[model samples]
Target: MATSTLSRWFHGNVGMVTSVIAAIAIIAIFQIINPFFLSPQGRVTLVYAMSYFLIVACGLTFVIMIGSFDFSVVSMLKLGAIICALYIDDLGLMVIPLALLACTAMGFINGLLFAKFKVPSFLATLGMSMVIEGIALYLSRGFLHIISNRAFRSIAVTFIAGLPSIFYWALAIWGVCIFIALATPFGRQIYAIGGNPTAASLCGINVVKKRIYVFMLSGFLSGLAGILYMAQFGGGSIEMGADMSIPLFASVIAGGTSLAGGTGGPQRTILGVILITWTQAGMSMNAIGHDIQLVVFALIAIGMSILTANRKTMSIVK
Candidate 1:
């Protein structure tokens, strides 16, 4: 029995082990190629970049957990950043909550269409994403806004105990997500609804309500990501979050989350994001072009997809 339990724990945590191994291997390769690759400044930049990807991945994790995809995450981030920037001067500290609320509303709308109206989550989110992109373009007119407020600036620029402020926020959010997934009744409901909505409904879970809640939470986190993105950029544009949806989704998949439904958590998604982000950072520092980075990421993602696909088969064979 003890051996069996140990095996279960190992299987469940294989993704984490993979991420650590990847991280260490990448560090070694980079160090060999460029002695300064693992320097203090480089490590700081790594954590800085990881903070944004981590927050975005956290939001994506919630959506993936519910067996739904939101293609509009990048758009949502842009919208949230623009909204927060617009209000930071007038609303001061309130800008943060207001932006998050707007993000939640957008997410709720997406969820309502999917959960209540029976619209497919992907299609609905895609349409909403287009709408958000259009609106964001209109609001900014393709220009970057330089927010000069000290309060807003501090969120992204300030640090404590040598850690980036954004890292703290991401860590806090991650803790909340961990608590939800591991301890909360609502979190279990998300897993149940994702794994089998029909079964969940029969078991007295309000599937629609649960989905809406998850979507709302997803949106709020996306918005929070935007705010953090803005802090890092010292301002933002309509293009702030462009091209993130695919990578974020790929990272979630790479982290060992099954797309067919509920079998993963934020831990997997965050680990995947860290690996991808580090890969990108290391490659970019090495002068690898964006095109090459995309290609490499695609190949890696494909390999991980195959692994994810074979998980059930591997289990059965064992």
Candidate 2:
């Protein structure tokens, strides 16, 4: 009877349990392989790596939870970073709004294309990414832009307690996402829509509006990530966030937020973020090359997708 109860609990909380196990195992393996992994400096490096990533992944969690995709998340982040780098000297604090507004607009377009025109979410966001990428490249002239603004840099780099300010920002945002997902009426609507769009619409949930708003929320968070990233690094370029797409997707899925929708939330993403970032950190400490890391990330993304994307409703979302 005890065995049966444990099995039932495991099945019911599979995502949570799996994510916890994977996160713990990753920490253990990395700590052993690179004794520096738990060292003070190594811990700082790990936090920085995951902080910006967690900010962006929070947005992806919302979209994925609703059985949708947003490939433009990374591109918009890049664009936001580039915008800040290019205009920080001129706009100072105001450039933030400009960057955020641009990202939000792009996200709105994504929503319109997918919900209004019936474009596949993946295809719609992919196409939007192309356009955003072009704009970013043109703005930066395919060159890296340095940001020398000490005030701007302080936004993310200033140490607070034992960690950087960006770490706190990421943590704060994660908490907000959790609250939004688990508490608000809007949150319930998100799960309802993801679980059954037709029923949600019939039940007065305003599926199209909710979708557009969700995409907009995604855009907003992605932009916030970009701004924070630019501040933390003191520079930006078109390539800044280019390779992040797969990792962020994997992080969200591995966190057990089902791509099938309505099964997970940001609460799980923190563990997945820790797991993936530490793996990368461990690999880097061992002198792993970029090529190897990309390959590994791709495999992880595929594996996680298989585990989380289990419902036919996922296919119908487009």
Name the lDDT value of residue 7 in candidate 2: 96
- Which regions in candidate 1 have their CA more than 4 angstroms from the true location? 1-14, 310-318
lDDT at 56 for candidate 1? 73
Per-residue alpha-carbon lDDT of model 2 for 1-318, expressed as tens digits? 999999988775676677788788888888888899889999899999999999899999999888889999999999889999999999999999999999999999999998888898999999999999999999999987899999999999999887899999999999999999999999999999888889999998999999999999899999999999999999967778767888898888888888888778888898788877878888898899978988887887777777666656666545
Mark the 10 consecutive residues where model 1 has the least summed lDDT.
309-318
Candidate 2 clashes between residue pairs 3 or more apart in a chain or in different chains? none
Candidate 2 achieves a global lDDT of 0.88
Model 1, total clashes:
0
Candidate 1 clash pair list = none
Model 1 scores a C-alpha lDDT of 0.79
| Clash count, one per candidate | 0, 0
